[model samples]
Target chain A: MRQPMTALERVHVTEVGPRDGLQNEERVLTTAEKVALVRALVAAGVKEFELTSFVSPRAVPALADAAELVAELKDVEGIHFSALVPNLRGAERALEAGIDSIVLFVSASQSHNAKNVNRSVKESLRDFEQIARALEGSPIELRGAIATTFGCPFEGNVDVRAVGNIARHFADIGVRYVSLGDTTGMATPPLVSERIWHLREVASGIEPTLHFHNTRGIGLANVMQGLALGVDRFESSIGGLGGCPFAPGASGNIASEDLVYLLTEMGIDTGIDLPRLIEAAHVATRLMGRPLPAQVSKAGPRLALSDCSAVPTARG
Target chain B: MRQPMTALERVHVTEVGPRDGLQNEERVLTTAEKVALVRALVAAGVKEFELTSFVSPRAVPALADAAELVAELKDVEGIHFSALVPNLRGAERALEAGIDSIVLFVSASQSHNAKNVNRSVKESLRDFEQIARALEGSPIELRGAIATTFGCPFEGNVDVRAVGNIARHFADIGVRYVSLGDTTGMATPPLVSERIWHLREVASGIEPTLHFHNTRGIGLANVMQGLALGVDRFESSIGGLGGCPFAPGASGNIASEDLVYLLTEMGIDTGIDLPRLIEAAHVATRLMGRPLPAQVSKAGPRLALSDCSAVPTARG
Candidate 1:
C-alpha cells in the first residue's frame, strides 16, 4: 500500500482543483467545501497544493475568498500551499495572508495576454518588474506559469521563443519552477516536448512541469512524453474539473487520479493515495451535483486483479 | 496538411465501431444503417474494418444482422472487411459470407474465457485447433486476439507468461498476427512495454497490434507506448464506441478519430482523413441518439490556428 511502491522515480504533482478548476466552473464552492477538498487532498498525500488564486472577485468570483482560503491552509503541515496571483495586488494579498508560495501568470501569446489580463505580454512583464521588486524581501517561493505555451487559440502555434522569454523573466526574478499551461487543452505530445526542450535550453536553472488538459484526450500521452523527457513535476486538477469560464463543457485539467495511475503503474512514484484522491473526486461530484469527467473515478483502478481467483469476468 | 509530413511511420487503423461498438451498446442499428456506416467508413479512407460478429443472434441481438452486414461490405473495393468469429460455426458462416479476414478471440485468463464463452482457457485452445485445421487454405487471413492479456476484470493481474503462451499457441496454429487486448482497460505503459517485450521474446514471428480501451482515460497514452514499442497496427471504434458487453457503462474501444488526431499531428500517415473520420463519429452519435464520448469531437481538432495573427484566447 506504499505510494510509489512501483514508480521508483518520484513524480511531484500540484493539485489545482481549488484554483484553476473551481475558477472555471459555474458552481462556486463555499469556503468550507473548498477547505474540505484541500484538506482531503493533503490527507491523500499531496505534497503541493495550488490552494487558491488571489484574483479580483470581479474577474473570478469562485476564488473571491482567495485570501481567506490561503490564510486557512497556510499552516497545513506536510504540504506546500500556494496561491495564484494575477498582478501585484494579488501578490500582496497572498503575501499578507502569510502564504509561503505564489504562482504568477502571463500568457505566451500576446493576444491571450490582452484578452486574459487586458495587458499585452510586454506590458505584463513590465508589471512583473514591480511585482518582483515587491517580493524581494518576502519569504515566498515564486513560480511563473506561461499559459498558452503549447498552442494559443487566438494566436495558434505559439512561438517557443515567446515562452522562453517569459521563463527568462521568471528566472531573472529568482523563480525556480515555471509551469507551461496548456490553457485550451490544445497541447500535443510533440508540441509539449518541443516547448519543454526549448524552455530547458533557455531557462536551464528552472524546473519545468507540464500542466495538461484531457480536452483532446491525449493529456496523459503528453505527460508520458514529458516523463520520458525527465520532467519530474506535473499539475493536474481533481475530478478532471475545470474549463475556460467562457467555454462551457470543455474539459479542465488532466484528472489527478488518472495521472497517478499512469505514474504509479510506470514505477514512478507519485506518493499520492490514488483511492483517497478518487474519493475526493467523488466528493467533488456530490458537491458539484454532477459527475466530473474523471475516467478512473468511473472505471475503477486497473481492476487490481491480484485479489481475485474466482472469475468475475461473467458480469464484468 | 499532408499526413506523414513529419511522422514518417505508416500506421494502419482498423475501424471496429460496427462490430465492437454496436455489440456493447443498447441500440441496434438496422442492416441499412450498418451498411451506411461501412460505406461512410470506406469513403473516409478506412482500409480495414471489423464490420460484424458472427455469433448467434440470441447471444448478441445487437449484431443479429451479422451475415447481411458482412455480405454488404465484403466486396467493397479498397477495403478489407473482417468479422469476429466466436467458434467453428461462426468461422464457417464468415468464410461462406466471403469475408476474407477473421479475428478469433480467446481470453488469456481462465475465468474470463469461462465467463465470456462458458468455456475454459484450455478448452478454447482445443477449439482453436479444430478452427485452424478448418481454415487451412480456406482463403482467409487468420489473426488471433488474446483478450484480457493485460489484466482480467474477473481474475485480475493475468500473468504475462500466460499471454506469451497464448501468443505462442496462435503462432503454432499458423496465425501470423496476434493482438493483445486490454479487455478491461487495465493496461499501463510499463505493463504494455514489458508484455510486448515478453510476447516478442516468446513469439518472434508474430506481429502484435495493441487494442486499447480508454476506460481509465489512458487509451491513447497506451497507444503511444505501443507506437514507441513499434506496434504499427491498432483497432479502435469511432466515437469511442464499444465497451465490454458484460461491463456496462464502461467505455469501449479508444476513439479512432482521436487516435487519428494523435498520429496525424505526429506526422504519421494513417491514410484516413481526420475530418471525415470525425464526421463519421458525428453520424454515430446522431444514429445512436446520444453523444458518444469522443474528446476531439468536442474540442474541434486543435483550432488549426492557421487563421490567427491576433490570439483569440477569449472563447478558445
Candidate 2:
C-alpha cells in the first residue's frame, strides 16, 4: 500500500464560518461580532476566508451586514477574502468593497438550484457569465462554487457528469478556482475520488477545492480520501457553526479547528496555528452562546495533558 | 494511488457500546435495558459484540450487572459475544456466563496502567497468565486489549516497542485477536501506520483490531487509514455513548451507525443494517435523556429524502 503524502506538502484551509456557517443559523450576529470572529481567526495564521455573501439582506438576514463586515476587516494584511455573489449586482458590490474574489454558485442538481437560488442551473450559469463579464478587466478574481455537487437533497446521487459540466462552464469563463460543495453533507470517499477523477478529465487545469460537511460524521474521512488523491485545498467552518435547516439536527460544515488539528497531526502544514485556531473556535462558541460541534476545541489537542490527579480513578 | 478496498472485502464491526460505552457513563442502565440494546443491535445484523465486562461492582458501578446482562443475552442465536475480564476471577465469571471470548486489557503506558487499574503493566500481564490458565481447556477464546496504544495522557507518545512487546505476550498466550485501543484519542494516521507495521514485525499472525476514539473528532478518519492498509476489523460504540471523563466534552468511541455508514458507502460489506442500527442509536439517546454524539442517527442516512416542500427557503 502507498504511504500518505509526507509533511512536505502544504494544505490550504479556507475558513468559511462567517458566510456558510452563519447563514443557516437562526440568530443573526452583529457586524462587530462577525469582525471579531474573523479577526480572531486572522490572528491564528488563517490566510484565506470566505468572508460573507453579498446577497439580498431579505434573503439571508443573518449576513445582512456583509459589506459592513468586509469593510471592517479591509485593512487586514496578506489575507485573501472571498465572498459569495449571486449575480452581477452582488459581484459589482463585492468589487466596490474591494473583495479579493467573488464566488458564483450554482447547484449541480437542477431541483436544488431552483430551490436554493430560485433559478435553474442554466440560469445560474448565465448569471455567472454576466458576473464574469463585469469583472473582465478588474483585479478581482472569479471563482465558481457548485453546491450539491456530491448529492442533492431533493434529487439524490448527483451524476458526476453534472459536476463536470458545471466545472466546464466555470473553466470556460477563466475561473481557475472551483469549489465542489457537499451542500447536504452527502459526500462519500468513493464519490470524492470519482468527482476528482471526472474534474481532471473534463475540466483540466482548474484547481478543485473540496468543501465537505460533517452532517453524516464522515467529513474528515472524506478529507482523507481527498488527501490520498493528492488534492490539497479544503474549506471548513470554525466551531462547526452551521447546522442544516432541513435535517433539523445535522451538522453543517466540518469544523475549521478540527480540520487544522487533523492536518497538523498528519504532518501536513496548513499555515494555521492549531492552539490559536482553537481559541478562535472558542470565540465563535462564546458569540454563538452555545457549545459548537467542534471536538478539538472542547477536547484540547492530543498532547494537551491533564494532571494525573485530576483524572478520576475509574475503569477506562 | 491505490484505490480503496472494494466491496468484495468484508469488514467486521464489533459493537462495543454495551461494554466500553456503558462502563464510562454515570447513569446506570437496568440489566433489561442492556439486554434490549444488545437485542436491537442483534436484530440489525450485528454478529459480534463486546457485550459487557465482568469487573468488580465496586470498581465499575455502572456495569455492576455485567454477568446478569450476559445471561439475559445468552439465547441470542448466531451472535458472537465477548466480555472484558480483569483477572482469573472475572474470566471465570465470563466463562460461566458462556461468553465466546474474554478480552484482557493493559495500558501500553505503564503510568496509565497504574492510574487506571492501580497495577503495573507487568502485573496486568501476569494476571492475564492466570486468566489464560483458567481458560486453558475451556472453549472460550482469549483476546488482548492494549490501552493507550497510540499515546498516553500521563506519558505522551508511547513507544511502538511497548505495543509490540504486549502483542508478542498476547500471541505467546495463544491469543490471536489483539485490539490497539486509542484510549485517549491520540491515534493519528502516521502513528496508526507505524504501530501496525511494528505489530506485523513482532507479533506476526495476530489479527489487529483498531479501536479509536473521536476525542479530537478524527476517529472515522483513522478508520479510513486502517481500511487503506487492508485492515477490516473495527470497534465502535452505539450513539457514541462513551465520553472521556478526563476531557469533559471529548467523545469516546466512534458511533457505530456512523462507522457502518462509512463502510457501506465505501462499498465494503459489514453485513450490518444501517436504518435499524440508527433506530438502536435512537433508543440509546432516549434512554440517556440527552443527545448522543453520533451524527448519523440525528442526520439520517444520505438517501433519506425530505419533502422538498418542508424545506424552508434559505440561502445555501
Candidate 3:
C-alpha cells in the first residue's frame, strides 16, 4: 500500500471551536473572549472559522452574543466566517450579521430531529429548502449539515441510505456542501466509511465534509477512515469543544489541534501551525477552567527527535 | 470500499491486562488477585491470557509472584497461558513455572534497546536466538515480539524494514509467531497498515499478531486498519491496563474490554462477552483503587437507546 497524502495534499480543515464549542459550554464565554479566541485562531493561520450560531437565545444561551461577536471580528482577514443557522430566521439573522457563509443542519435520524428541533425529518428538510431558497443569489454560501449521519442516540442504527437521501436532496436544492455530523459521538470507523461511501455514491461528485466527536474516544480513528475515503474537508472544534444539547451523553467535538497534529504528522498539509493551535488550546482550556478533551493538548505532538531535543542525548 | 468486517466476524482477542497491565501500576496486585482476574477473564471467554513475566524481581517487582500465580491456576482448561521471558534465564524460569508458551521481546530501535534492556539491538537479537534455540523441538512454542514497530519513544519514526529484519531474524530462529508492538502509542492507521504489510512481505507464512497501546487514544483505529489488512489476532489488557516500563511516556496497553466491545459491536468474533469483561474490569479497578483506562467501561457499549426507559417496558 502507498503512503496516504497529508492534509496539505488534499484536505482543508474548517475550525468550528469558537462557535460550536462554546455554544454548549455551561459557563458562557463573553462576546469579547469569543472574538479574542477567533482572532487568536486567525493569527494561527486558520483559514476557516465557524464564528457562532444564529439560534434563539433560549435554545443556546451560551451563544446569545453571536451577532456581537461576529460584528466585532468583522475586520479579521483571510478567514471565512460562517454561522450555524437553524432555519430561515437563523439564515436571515446570520446574513444580517454579515456572515460570508451559513450552515443549515438537518438530522438524518427522524427521532433525533423530533427530540432536537421538535420537527420530523421531512419538516426539517422543508425548513432547509426554505433556508436555501431564502439565501438564493446572496453572497452567503449555503451549506447543508446532516446531523447524526452515522448512528443516532434516539434511533439505534441510522441507515446510510437515509443520510444519502438527505445529501442528494440538499444537492438537488443547490446546496454546495454537506457535512455529515456524528452528532452523539456514536460513529466508529466502519460507520464513518459506510456513510461517506453512501453519500459519495448517491451524490456523485458532491463530497460531504465529515464532523466527528471524541465522546467515545475514537475521533482520530474516524478521521483516518474518512481520509482514506478521500474526504478532504472536515469540521472540528478547537480544544475538542462542542456537543448537541438535545443529545444526551454527548461530549466535545473532535479537537482541531489534535486533528491538525494527526494530519500534519502523516505528512498531510494542514495550513494551520500546530504550536499556534496548541497555544489556542491553552487559552480555551484556561477559559473553560477545566481540561478540554484534546489528546494533542494533553500529549504533545508526534515530533521528530530533531524537533524534540536537537541534542544527541543518551536514551533513558 | 466494502465495510470492514465486524469485530465478531474476524478477530480473536488475547487479554494481556493481567501481566502487562498490573506490571505498570504503582500498587502491586497480590498473586491471588492476579489469579482471580485471569480466572475472571477466562470465564469471560478469553482464550489466551498473558499471565505474568519471569523477569527478575528487581526489574518488575509487580509480577514477582509469577510462579506462585501460575501454580495456583494450573487446572484452568480451554485457555492458553503465556508468560513474558526476557532472556535464557527468564525463559528457564517460565518453563519451570509450567508455561509452555513464551513471548520474547526485542526492541527494533537501537536507541530503545539501549535504554530499555541495556543492550544493543544485535545483542538483544542474539539473546532472542538463544531463547528460541533452547525452546526448539520441545512442545513449547516461542513467539518473538518486535517492540516499537510503528514509532519509538526514544528513536522516533522506526524504519519498517528494521522491524521486518528483526521479525525475519526471529522467523529464522524457529519462532512461529511474530508480534509487532506499538510500544509508544504513536502509530496512525496508515503507519499500522504500512508496518503490517512490510512485516508480511519480510516474514511470509508467519502469522503476526498486533499489540497496540491507546496512550494517544487511537488504539481501536489502528486495530481497524490491521483488521482491514487481514490480521486476526490481537493483544489487549483488561480495562486497558499495562504500560511499558521501558517506554517512559507510554500509557496503558489497549483496553481488552474496549477492544472486545469494538470488535463484537462491529460483528467481529472475539467469542468474549462484554458484560463479563466489564465485571473483570471492575475487579481490576477495585484492586487498582482507581478506574482503569477502558473507554467502554466508563461509557457503556455504543447503543442507540441506552437510557430509554421504554426499552424495558417494550421488551416486557
Candidate 4:
C-alpha cells in the first residue's frame, strides 16, 4: 500500500515589513510611531523582526532615525531584532544600537548590483567577505542577502546557477543564513522552486531564506512554492512597503500581515495573532496617511463558519 | 536511488476578467466598450474568455447588456466564450445570447448561499440539477461553481469534505467541470491543495477549476497550489473586479493580466499577449473611471536581461 500523505509542516515567518516597508515609503515615520508599530507586531507574536537599516541617511533617508528607533526599542523582549547593513560601518552601527542580528545584502545580478548598491557582484562579494571577517566572534548572527535572485528589472532573468554560486560563496564565507530576493517581483512558482533548489544544492548545509515582492502580485505564490521546497524563513514588509526605487512602478515588499495570515490559515503555526497584526497594519497606514498595500488590511481574516456564527455582530 | 524531481506540468489559465470582472464594477460599461475590451483580449490571444453573465438585470445590473454584448461579438472565432447563470432562466438567456458554455454558481456555506442567491445549498443544488437536465443533449456545457469553498466570511473555515460532497453532487448530476471559489480570499496554499485533492477524489473524472479572490493577498498563492494539483482552468477578473457582495471586506478576483503574465513567465502557454491585455485593462479602467486592481497594469512585465537591455527607457 502507498504511504499516506504526511501532515504539512509549519513555516517560520521573518517579518521585514517595518524596516523594508517604511524605508521605501515617501513619508518618513516618527521614531515613536515606528516603535509603537513594532510593539503591536510583537504583541501579535511575530518573533523575527527586521527593525531598520543602518545605511547612510543620504542613501535611505526614511531610515535615518534607525539608531534612535533601535535605542528606544531596547525594552522590547522575546523577539529577534535585526537591522540591514551595507558594509562594516553599518554593521558596527547596528551592533552599537544593540541589535540582535545584522543582514548584509548583495545582488545576484551584476547590473542590479551596480544600479542598486553601486557595486558589481564581485565587488560586493569582496565587501561581504571583509564584513564577515570583521564581525567574527560577535554575539550578532550574520545573514547574507542575494537581491534579484529570480529576475531583475534591470537585467531581466537571472541565472539559477549564478544565484547558486552566490549562495555557495556566502556559505564559504561562513554565513549560515542567506536570503534570495525577488527584487523586482518577477519570480513565479517554477522559477522560485528552481532557484531555491539550486541554492540548496550548492550551499549543502546553509539554510535558505526568501524575500519576495508583490510588485507583479505573485509574492505569496512564490512563497508557497518556496515552502514546497522546504524553505520556511521569509522576509516580508508590513503593509507591503520597500518597493524598488530603481525599477519604476514596482511596489513594495510582500505584506507581513498577509503572509502571516496565509501561513496561519494553512494550519501552520506562525505564532502570529491575525487581528492584532491587522491592527498594526492600520497603525502603519495611519503613519503613511494613505492605505498601505496589504490585502488583509481591507479583507478581514478568513474565519470558519463556526467562528463567524459565534461572533455576534450589529450588522447581522 | 531517489527519483529526480519531476518538473511541474503546465497550468491552464481561463481569463474571466471581462465577464465576471465588469459584473461587479459600480460603473456600467457600454456594449461597444465591452466588445472592444474582448477584442483586445482576443488580439492578446486569450483562448478561454468568460464573455458575460446572463443573469437578470435586476439581480446584477452591471451585466444588464450581456446579451447585446454577446450578439455583437458572435463573429470572434477560435475562442471559448462562457456565460454565468443563476438557474434555468439564466441558462436560457445565455443560450439565446449564442453562448454555448455556462458556469453555474452555488455556495458551499448555507448562510452564504442564502445571502448570495437567496436560497439554501439544498435549494440551489436542486435548481442546478433541474438546469443540468434542461441542458442535456445540447451543445451547452455546464460548469458547477462552489463559491466559498475555501472559507466563508460569515462562517470561518469550511470543511473540505463538505466541498467534496458538493462536487460529487455536481458530478453525479452530469456537470462536466467544477470550480471551487475562494470567495472571501481565505484560501491558503495547503487549504487549496487539500480541497482540490479531496474534490478531485469525490468528483472522480471531473476536472476542477478555480476562482480566486485577492482579498487576503494570497490569491496567486492559492492559484499556484491549485496548479500543482493539476487544475488547469481559473477564473480571473480584468483589473480584479467583482468583489463578493455577501462576503464583507472581500476584494475583487485575481487580475487576468497579472495571472497571464505569471503563467507566461513560467513557460506555461497562456496564449495571452501581456502588453495587449494591459491595453484592454486600460480601456476597462477608463470605463470604470478608476484604476482596476491589476498589479501588471501598474507594474510592467518581467523581462529577461536581454529584453530589458534592449529597451531604451528603464521604466515603462
Candidate 2: stretches off by over 4 Å: A1-8, A246-248, A307-316, B1-8, B307-316
For model 4, how does the per-residue alpha-carbon lDDT over A1-316 read when each residue is reduced to its tens digit? 1111224456678888767677666778888888888888888788988888888787777788988998898887788988878777888888888899888887788877776667778887888898888888988888888877877766677788888888888888888888887766777777877776677677876788888888888888778777767787888887776665544444678888888887776667777888988888888877778766787876666663322221111011
Stronger candidate by TM-score (1 vs 4): 1
TM-score of each: 0.93, 0.96, 0.89, 0.89
Interface C-alpha RMSD per candidate, 1 decimal? 6.9, 4.6, 8.5, 8.8
- When only the first chain is scored, the TM-scores of the models are 0.92, 0.95, 0.90, 0.90
lDDT by residue (tens digit), candidate 3, A161-224: 8888888888888877788887767788778777777777789746688888776666777787
lDDT for B47 (candidate 2):
96
Q: Which residues of candidate 4, in runs, are more than 4 Å off?
A: A1-8, A244-250, A304-316, B1-10, B133-137, B159-162, B244-250, B304-316
Error of 1 at B130 (Å): 1.4
Best by lDDT: 2
Model 4 chain A, poorest ten-residue lDDT window?
Answer: A307-316
lDDT of 3 by residue, B1-316 (tens): 3365543366767777877677777788888888888888888889988888887787777888888988998998878888888788888888888886888887888877776677888988898887777877777778777877877777778888898888888888877777788776777877877887787788885678899877655677678678767788899898777654433333478888777876775667778988888888888888888656565665566773544211000000
User: Which segments of model 3 are wrong by more than 4 Å?
Assistant: A5-8, A243-251, A304-316, B5-9, B243-251, B304-316
When 1 and 3 are scored with DockQ, the better candidate is 1
Q: Please, what are the lDDT tens digits per residue for candidate 1 over residues A57-144?
A: 8766787887778767756876788887878887888889878788888899987788878888888888778888988987988888
The DockQ of predicted model 2 stands at 0.50
Per residue, candidate 1 scores C-alpha lDDT tens digits across B1-316 of: 1212133388989888888788878788999888877777777899988888788787778888877777776567867877878788888888888886888888998877887778888888888889889988889888888888888877778888899998898889888878788877888887888888898899998989888888888898888888877889999999888764444344678998889999888878889998888788878888888767777776778875422222122211
List lDDT for all candidates, in order.
Answer: 0.79, 0.87, 0.75, 0.75
Model 3 residue A219 distance off true place after TM-score fit, in angstroms: 2.7
On a 0 to 100 scale, what is the lDDT of residue B25 in model 1? 80
* Candidate 3 local Cα displacement, residue A50, angstroms: 2.5
